[model samples]
Structures are given as structure tokens and as C-alpha cells.
Target: MNYIWDLIIKSERAGIAKRDISFAVAEVYSPYMELSLESLNARTAERRVELNPYYRFDHIFDGMFDINNDEDVELREQLFDILIHFLADIDLTQGLNKREFYIRFALRDLENGAYGDKVMRSIGLFGREERDMIALNLLRLYETGEAVYLLKDTMRKVFKRSTIYANCEEKDELLVYVGQEETEEARAKVGLIMDIFLPVRFHVEFYWNRHFGILGLEDTMRQDGIAMY
Candidate 1:
């Protein structure tokens, strides 16, 4: 996501140190670094086949040793794109958690300056109940080792749907499919979740089929520009 990177660049320009940005970026991409080269090759190849039949992973990984290396602009850009797509395609809750980690890293480095305050407000800092919920859920996750399941369950209840789908898009926004039910109600539920539960800084969108399997099935209802809670 260029927007995420742009935020880092903007923060640096706003007086945050380059090392801090690098550290945050490193943390964001650390999950990729842990994967084996063979695993990366296979996964990237599979993704390329689905996305671009003509794209070759070999060209991107041929001489690439470090993705963070800046000497070869082409390699770096390609690798960054791969990582971005990889992150986008993963589980929604996991992706948002990683994003939250990145935001926290930036905030820690920025501290209490004007830029930091702006970022803080943009991310919607947690209040007492939200903070307590986070702590309680973390403990539950540690004890049961089902953190994703817990989040998915909470989401299911909030949307009033037994089966709902969630995905993180390329723009780092969360998209939730709430079926063909009451769209306004779904929006309100999402607003509440964003306000009380979401720990990360990113936008969310609710998608529904307005026509409900009718002639206008191709047309989808989308609600965006949701205010941060």
C-alpha cells in the first residue's frame, strides 16, 4: 500500500527520524522475512498465476537478496508490491492486527508532537472500556489460542449474521459482507465496532447486494467514509 508507506514518508518529513520509519517498516514486513525462500517462491508463484498469467516470479527474485535494499529500485518495488498483495490477501483480522502494530510503532516514535497527535486521533485512541476489552481478549487468546476465532465470532454477532465474509483490500481497508439484510442496521453495527473494538487505524466498508438476487444482482451496495470510532 503506497498510502501506508506515504504515511511513513510524511511522518519522516514531519520530523520523525528515518531510523524509526525503517524500524516500523521492518516490523510490518517481518512476517515475510520469516518465510523460507522456497516458500516465498511457491506462494508468490501461485499468486502470480492467479493475478497475472504472464508474470514471472523468477524475474523478481533472481538477484534479490534483501527486500529492504534500495540499490535496485525495480527489485525493491516489485518485492514491495508482492508483500503488499500478500498482506492484503491474508485473514482480515490478522491483517488489521499487523497494521495496528505498524501504527503503534509509528506512534511510539512520534510521541506527543503535533504530527503524533494527528496520527493518534486518526487511529482513534482507545478509551477505558476499549483498552480493557483489548486486554481481556488478549488474555483469552493466550489461554485458548483462538484469537482469530474470537474476533470472527464477535464480528458475526455484531453484523447479526451467522455467515459473514471479511477481507482486507489493497488500500488497507476492511470490507465486510453483510448479506442482503437491513443495510442501515449493518452500518450502525460497524460504527459501533469501529468505535469500541477495532484497535487499528484503517477505514472499513460494508457491502451488500441491494437487489437480493433480482435483475440488479450485478449492482452492489457499498458504504464507505465511515467515521472513526
Candidate 2:
């Protein structure tokens, strides 16, 4: 919970608007919880649900954080605090929904490390037999921006001689440009390595020295013995 508050404060210091920060938090937390603007409005307007004393926010707003309204701001803060605590207490190994479990798992991984190569490898093995594309897509979308930032940092470290620029062109596509010349094998290797770390639905495209390309994931089987992409 403190981590979430710290993130909001850090984002504010980094010049991100309050509304964007709210949306970012919503993006990560909404999927795990039954959160919707309409439901929140209705619930908060009616008799308060007594989940906890500190979590008294009626509902989360759609876009703007409404900083001008003191109650609204306070409610938003309370809602986030409530969510963080609620999510933290959920037992992932119990009878939780698979999607919720994976989303929570991925969020934990991201917070621990920005889905680095080693973390990705571990998650890949952990989820190797799982094949819920929708859940994976949600995780990928939530981490897309951070993944780009981490990818750029990784490229800077790995290819010091080359200037690397990485950007998320769409929700699911990452475009990476390497200034120096790279062989076909080198480009494929870069793409393949990143593909292994990213969500199954997300794709990475590499462009270097006028060459453009992408890597493909191998067909794999799930725990149910069904083949998956």
C-alpha cells in the first residue's frame, strides 16, 4: 500500500498528471478487483459497505482525479489504499480466479523487478503450462510502458556501442531501433530474447541499420495438453 502511495508521489514529482496516475493505478488494479465507475458510484452513494474503516470511498471516477474537490481527492486516495490492502491480503494459492491470480502474480513480479530477463525466465517457466491469452494480454498491457523503459535501459547496458531507442507504438507492439549495423542473427537474437520475457500477446520489432524484423514464439502445449501460440 505504501508502495502504491510512493508510486503516486513519485509520478507526481516526475510531472505526470493526477488523472493519468489514477488511470495507471486503475489499469493495474481493476482487473484483479471488481472495479467499475458505475458500481463504485452506486456503492458509495448507498449505505457504506464496511470492508474496513479506512476504505470509505464510494466509487472511483472515470478519468480526472477531481483535485479541486477535497472529498473526491480523499475518496480516491482512500479507494487506492483500500485496494492495495485488499489485493495484498488475497491468497493466490486458494480458490482465487485464475485470471486474478495471474494478474496479481504478474504485478508482484513487476514490482519486484521491471520484468527483467531473469524474472521473465522464471515466470515463463512458472506459467509455461498456462494458456489464458486474455489474462496474459491484460498483464502485458498493464506493463507495456514500464517494459519499454526497461527495454531501453537493457539495450543501453547490453549494446553500449549502439544507440538504442525503444517505444511502445501501440498497446501491444514495441518498436526498437538500434543505430549501428546488426546481422540478421543478431536482430533475431535480440527479438527472441525479448519475446521470451514479454507477454505472449505482445510483440517486439527491431530495426537496425535499415533492416527491420520480428521474432516468433514457438508453438507450445498447455497443462490441459492443448497446443497454444
Candidate 3:
């Protein structure tokens, strides 16, 4: 919980501001793959009752997260509940709906990491088996922190911004142009342009809090797993 506060403050300072604080909070609390399978299984049980007040099989069949999309009523219910629990437990603010929040944030994370294609392949919320497998693999990467870093690196490459200064008369207006050259050298040393590595400072500071916070998450790292330096 202390880590939660630190993240809030860090994000607040990093241009996140108060408007999207709940979203940031939800992102920080989201569980990775290292969490026990039993936790997810337990959530499934609880979700069944909450989602299906009537407890009817046919009506809620389409809502289940299944590979086959078959009417396996029992398994479907369990899957739906587990997914719901996984989503709800992340953040429980009054205005936020669990399912909607998860889907939206997941999309943002994917976009930030340039993993949109991988996420699409996983079909996580869309109920596809291949996509589910990819999601599981990606979760493993997240547990190791490699996935997060991988996404960060991709983001640095994708939305890399630059500033250019041109010598002009006092009355001359500024002009901006997009680069058309597809060469590495051109991309690297953009003429009259000052290149700066823009770090997503919020993520870095939030991770610092995550590393030092007393969540036992850092301690769970083995030599084979992720380690904070």
C-alpha cells in the first residue's frame, strides 16, 4: 500500500497529474505472471456469482473467455469469473468498471510497448486460444521485467521526439518539416536537430518505488528471474 502512495506522487510529478491518477494506480497494482495460479482460480469462483446473478448457463455463455467458444457452461463460468477477479482486484475505485478499465489500460500498455500486434495475436479478451498462449508467454516476460523493458525500448524508438533550431531573421516565422530519408545515419544525426533520449520518467520512478516497496515482489526474484539493480 505504501508503494501505491509513492507511485501516486511520482506519477503526479511526471505530468500524469490528478486527472489520470486512478488509471495509473490501476496500472501499478496490476498483477503479473509471478502471482500464484491459485489466486486467479479463487477469483474465478467469486466472479461467477457476481456476474451471473441468475446463474443461468445459456444467457452468459458468450461472456466466457474460452478458446473453443463452446458452451462448456461450467468452464466458461470459471474463466469469466477468473478474468473478472483479475481485472477487479487491480483497482476498485467507485467510477471505474473492472472489465472496461482492464481492457483500456491493457490497450495503452500494448501501445506504449508497441506490442499491439502481439496483444492482438493473444486474443486475450476476444477469446482466442493462440492469443491466450501468447498472453501467457508475455506474462512470463512481464514477471521477469524483460517484457516491460522491451516495451520501453520499443517506445523510445517509436515516439522519439526532437527539437530543431534554425537561424532566421528576427521577423521570420518558424518552419517544421518531417524527415523523408529512411537511412540510419539520417535518423541518428538529424541535421539542425537536437536529439534527446526522452525517458518515460514516470515509469522509471514508479519502478524505483516498486523495487524498494515492501511488497515482497522484489524478494521473489531468483537468479533465473528478474533482479533490480
Candidate 4:
């Protein structure tokens, strides 16, 4: 995206602004501003890929277990540690300092050798399609109504298996049935829907390896008095 910073001139005695000089300066400094803008965008997830793809994808998976990604948390911690250590001594009295100091150590504990689950090789980059998909999905999440059927539909799009709500009868609580095969990314999306999108008055909980209600046999499979489960 070609961009330029307009030069404004306001002089009392000699108001002279040459188009040729203005064009030349604009041409020279345009690239600098472009790079500067990109550098500023480096601080954000949407444009972080331009400077570092590793960091961008790491934010998506909340630090994948891939060593290739540090699971994402390691590199950030390393840089933060160097900056914190620069303070001469990490005094745990200051709130920000204390949080950063302890959080770094706790994250390191999550490393856990990365023996079998180390993220190796490419976990893939965040391209235009992934970005667009997320945007569209977010639109669906926000636009979709908050009824039982609507919530289930949104979850179906995110997870392969159908998400059964157990506590639908209870007005104040929602119980989500869980399956073990879901990916971390999928779980993260589900968590976002439950934690961020759900109304404040409702309590959401997840239960695994159990069914909360009686199973109803499908009408299509019922024949004579016996039905397939």
C-alpha cells in the first residue's frame, strides 16, 4: 500500500512550496513511513506475520506444544527475561515486575521436556484464508441468536462432533458434553464462545465421560419395538 505524509506550509513572509521538491521528498520518505507502519503493526496479531510468523501463530494456539513454536511462549519469555534481568535485580515488590517474574518461571515449567508432544516442523502460517475464515466465523458467532438451537449450530460448525447440552432444563446453568478428540484450537474456540460470548447470568460447565440424561432412540431407526442405540 503506497502511502504519503502531506506537507503543510504556512509562512507569513514567503509561502513557497515546490511541487517538485514535495514529490521528491515524498518519494524518498514514503518507503520509510511504509516500513515504519509495518513495524508498528508488528505489535499486533493481524500484521505480526510480516515481521514474525512464529509469534503470530503462537498467539492463535495460545502457545502450541510445538518446539518449532516454543510452543510460542518460550521466545517471548526469553526476550522478557532479558529485559527484566536488565533491572539489576528482579525485586518482587512491584506488581508488574512481580507478575512478569513469576509468570515467566511458571511458563517454563509448562515446557515439560516436550518429548512426545513437541511441535516440530511447520504448524502452517496464518494466510488470507485463515484470517477471513476467523472473521466470518466471528460474524456468525455474534449475529447468531442466543437460543439453544442457535448455540448448538455454532458449536457444530466449530467441532466435528455434536455438542450436547445437559442442563438445558436448568435456567441458570449450561452443561457442555465433552469429547476427547477435539484439538486445542477447537477447544479454544469453544471456550471463547462459552466464556466471552455467553450471557453473564448463565453458568457454563463441561463434563466428560458421562451422559447427563436418558438417551432417546431415533424415530427413523425404530422398528416394531426394537431400536438401534
Query: Pick by lDDT: which candidate is best?
Result: 2
Task: Give per-residue CA lDDT, model 2, range 54-110, as digits (tens).
Answer: 222335333334336556666676675555444433422346677767766664664
What is the descending TM-score order?
4, 1, 2, 3
Tell me each candidate's TM-score: 0.25, 0.24, 0.17, 0.31
Better of 1 and 2 by lDDT: 2
Candidate 1, poorest ten consecutive residues by summed lDDT: 45-54
Best candidate (score: TM-score)? 4
Off by over 4 Å in 3: 1-163, 181-229
Clashes of each: 0, 1, 2, 3
Per-model RMSD to reference = 20.2, 17.8, 20.0, 19.8
Q: lDDT tens string, model 3, 42-160?
A: 32211112222122232534434444555775765556545444343443344656654554554455435455454333233222222223334344454565543433333223324
**TM-score (C-alpha, index-matched) for candidate 3:** 0.17
- Mind giving the per-residue lDDT tens digits that candidate 4 earns over 140-197? 5456754455456545555445465535464777666554445665565565445434
Between candidates 3 and 4, name the one with more favorable TM-score: 4
User: Could you tell me the lDDT of residue 143 within candidate 4?
Assistant: 65
lDDT of each: 0.40, 0.43, 0.33, 0.37
User: What lDDT tens digits, residue by residue, belong to model 1 across residues 1-229?
Assistant: 1223333334433444323332112223223232222233331111111121112333544444455666967666566555544443342235356546654444443334433344334323333334334444544545686644555555564444433333455544555556546554455545544443343654555555331222343443224422221
Of 2 and 3, the candidate ranking higher by TM-score: 2
